[model samples]
Target: MDQRTDRPLSPYRHFSRADWARLREDTPMTLTQEEVTRLRSQHDRLDMAEVEDIYLPLSRLLSMYVAATQRLYRAQQKFLGTGDAKMPYIIGVAGSVAVGKSTTARVLQALLARWPNVPRVDLVTTDGFLFPNAVLERENLMERKGFPESYDISALLRFLSDVKAGRRPVTAPIYSHLVYDVMPNHRVEVDRPDILIVEGLNVLQAGRPPRDGSAVPFVSDFFDFSVYIDADEPVLREWYVDRFLRLRGTAFSDPKSYFHRYAKLSDKEAIDTATSIWERINLVNLTDNILPTRQRAGLILKKGANHLVSDVALRRL
Candidate 1:
C-alpha cells in the first residue's frame, strides 16, 4: 500500500504493522534469535519475528539513506576540491523511560552493522552526560534526575558537535546504573564510526532560542534520522513499575548498588515505592519534556500494551 493519504495537512502518514512489514521486501535477515535476545532489554521482549517485521524494514531504509548521504558527500568533495573526512551518519532514538528505547537502539545497531557494506556502528546513550549524583544532590536536583535541568547539556551538545565535525577519538563520560552516578574518569570513545546511534530520553528535545535568533545547536541538529518510541502514559507507567520490580531482585540486591536498600522491600512496598517514584520523577519528566518532542522525530514507533510496536508513523518529506 502507498503512504499517500487525503489529509494533506497531516505531517505523518500512518502505517499498520502489516503494511510496514511489506516494506522489508526481500531484505535479508541478519539477526539470529539468540542475537536478538542479547540485544533486548530486560523488560523488553524482541524475538526474531519482530526483527523481521519491524527492524529489517527500518534497517533497509536507513541503509538507503546512509548510502545516499555518502554519495552526496563524495559529490560535494569533487565540486569543492576538499579532502575532509565524511561525517558520521547520526541517528537519534528518543522515548520516555522504560519504553524500550534501549532495546530499539541496540537492535538497530546490531542490524545496521551487519549490512553487507560492513559499516561500523556505535551506540551512545545520553545517560553518560547526566550530572553526577553528588552534583545533583548539591544542586537540589536529585529529585528531578531525568528532567532537562539534570543534564550537562553543554557537554552533550559539544560531543555531538565534535562527532559531526569528524573529530577523531571523541570521548563521552561513562555512567554506572548500579551506583546511579557518573563513573570517575571512565569514558567511551567515538572514533569516526560510519554510523552513530544516540539513544536517550531527551535527545530530541530543543531549548528556547535567543530573541535575536543566533544559532543554538541542539542534540538533534546532527542527526541524519531520528526515531521516537511511543506508548500511552499508563502503558509506560506499567512498564516502568515492572522494570523496577525486576531490578529489585537483581541489580538492587547488589551490595554496591545505590538502590540496594530497595531489595528487601515487600511487594506492596515495592509497588508503592515504584509508583511514587514514577509519579514524582518519571511521569513529571515525561509530561513536561519528553512527550512534547515526539513529533520532531522523522519516525515514530507506536507501541501496544504488549510493549511491541503496533504502528509506525513517518513524517512526510
Candidate 2:
C-alpha cells in the first residue's frame, strides 16, 4: 500500500505576522491614528499596529506591483502604437461575509492613494451588483442572495470590461445595507484611476468553464492582484454574530432600517436569530462559494481568533 501523504504542495510562501511586519522595511506609514480608526467598521478589531504590521508591508508590495504593471502597460501601448487612455490596475479583495474584506479594501485604498505620484485609487464593492430585493423576491431567490446566480454577473462583467478597455466615467450601481437593497436609480461613478479595489464575498470565484472553450470572463480576470481574508469557521461565526448583535442597538433600531424588527429581540433571542441566519444564509454561502476561491488569491491574510492577522501567505509567481 502506498503510504505517501495526500496533501498537495502549497503555491504560497507563508510568513508569520512578525516576519511579514519586517518586510515593511522602510515603507513609510502614511495613515494617521484617526484615519485608521475612521476606516475600521463597528466590529473590526484592526488598529494602528495592525495597519503598520499587516497593511504597510502589503501597501508597499502593491505599490511596487502597480508601478511595474503601469510601466509594462505603457510599453505595450507604445509597441502597438495605440493612443488609448491610461489603463487602471484592478485589485480584488475576497473573503467570507464577516471576515473584514471592506476594512482591508479601505485601508489599502487609503495607503495606495497616499503613494507619491499615484493620483487616484477608487474602491467599489460587489454588493451593488446584487439583484434588487424585489427581483430576488420575484425569483424566489431571497435565500440565495449572496450566491453567484443572485448577481447581475453580465452587467458586472461588462462594467469591468469597459474599464479595462480604457472607458471613462464608468458607473456602478449603489447598494444600501441600511435598507437591505440595491438603491433604485442610484449609482457611483468610477473614472480611470491609477488603482481600483473591488471587494466582495466571492470576487475570486471562477465557476466551472464551458466545455466549448469559449471565452468566459470572470470578475477576477481583470485583477492585477487579489487578496483573500481567512479565519477559522468558529471565529468567523463569532464575528458575524457579534456584528449582528451590535447592529441591534444601532442600525437595526432605526425605524427605517431593514432589520428594524430584529432590534426588539431579547439578548438570547437575538443570539439565536443571528446564529440561525448565519448558519442558514452566510455560512452556507461561504462554504459553498467563497472559501473554495481562497487558493486563487495572490495573497491570503490568515486571522487568529482575536481577529488579528496571524500570518501572511504570498503566492509564489
Candidate 3:
C-alpha cells in the first residue's frame, strides 16, 4: 500500500491500527459509547471500538504535543523577557470532502476536552469562511464553492491571526448547510480555548508568494499540529454519493432547503446528479488543491473502504 504517495521519501513513520493501538497503553479511554455516537456525523459509521482503537491514542499523542508546546512557549517568553501567557494549541484537520474530517474534528474535540490538562477545546470549520452565495454568484464562482479561490482567504487569515494572538471571543461567521450559504449576522464565538481545532479542505495548502517578495503566511502557519484524513479516490466518490442520497431523503426534503429540488429526484436521478457533482466539482478541488497538501500534514489518518482508520502516519521530528 503506497500510503504516502505525495512524498517519495516520506518523513512519516507509518503504523497499522494494531500497532497504533498499542501506543495507547495506560492512556485512559475516557469516552463512552454514547459520546462516540453523539460525535459521529449523520450517515457516518463510528463505533466505540473504532474510537478506542484510533482516536484515544491520537488524543493522547496530541495532549503530549500540546504540553510540549506550552513548555516551549514559556521558555521563549523567559528568553525574550516577556510576561507568561499561554497560547492556545491550534490543530488543523484537512481532507477531501465526504472523507469524515468533520467527524474526526468533533471526536477529537470531545476526547481532548475530557483530558484534565486541556479542558476547553473549540472546533471551527472553515466552511464559515467561504464566500457567500451572492458574492460567489457575482464572481461566477457558485459552481466552484469548495475551491480555494471561492474563500475569503484574507478574512480567514485575520481570524486565525486573532486566535493565535489570544484575542478572546474571536467571532467567526456561521455557514448554513440547509441554506447553502454563509449566514449573515450569525457568528460563532471562540473564547480563549486551551485547544482549537480548525477543520477544512484546504487548511494544509501552501500560500502563494507575493509579487513584492515579502512573506505571506498561510493558515497552516498558525497550526501547532495538523492532521490529514486519507482515503482512496473511489471510496470518497462512493461516500459522497451516499451522503448526498441520505441528505436528499432528510435535509433536502425540507421545503426551506436550498437543495430541496434534489428531494424530488428519483433514486437513479439522484445517483446521477450526485455522481456528476462529485466528478465536476469535488474531484477537481481534491486533485488540484487538497491532495497536493497531504505531505504538509504532521499526521495522516488513512481510512479504508469501511470508513474506519486503518493506518496512521506520523511525521518524524
Best by TM-score: 1
Highest lDDT scorer = 1
Residue 192 Cα positional deviation in candidate 2, in Å, after optimal superposition: 0.5
Ranking by lDDT: 1, 2, 3
106, model 1: CA deviation in Å? 0.5
Question: Which runs of model 2 end up more than 4 angstroms from their true locations?
Answer: 1-8, 210-215
Model 1: lDDT of residue 223: 93
- Comparing candidate 1 with candidate 3, which one achieves the higher TM-score? 1
Q: lDDT values of the candidates?
A: 0.93, 0.91, 0.91
lDDT of 1 by residue, 1-317 (tens): 54565645668888889999999999999888888889998989788888998999999999999999999999999999999999999999999999999999999999999998899999999999999998999999999987888999989988988899988999999989999999989999999999999999999989875578565558898899999999999999999999999999999999999999999999999999999999999999999999999999999999999977899998888
- For lDDT, candidate 1 versus 3, the one ahead is 1
Tens digit of lDDT per residue, candidate 2, span 102-179?
999999999999988856999999999999999999999999999998999889988998888778889999999999
Superposed by TM-score, candidate 3 places the C-alpha of residue 268 at a distance from the truth, in angstroms, of 0.6
Candidate 1 lDDT (Cα, 0 to 1): 0.93
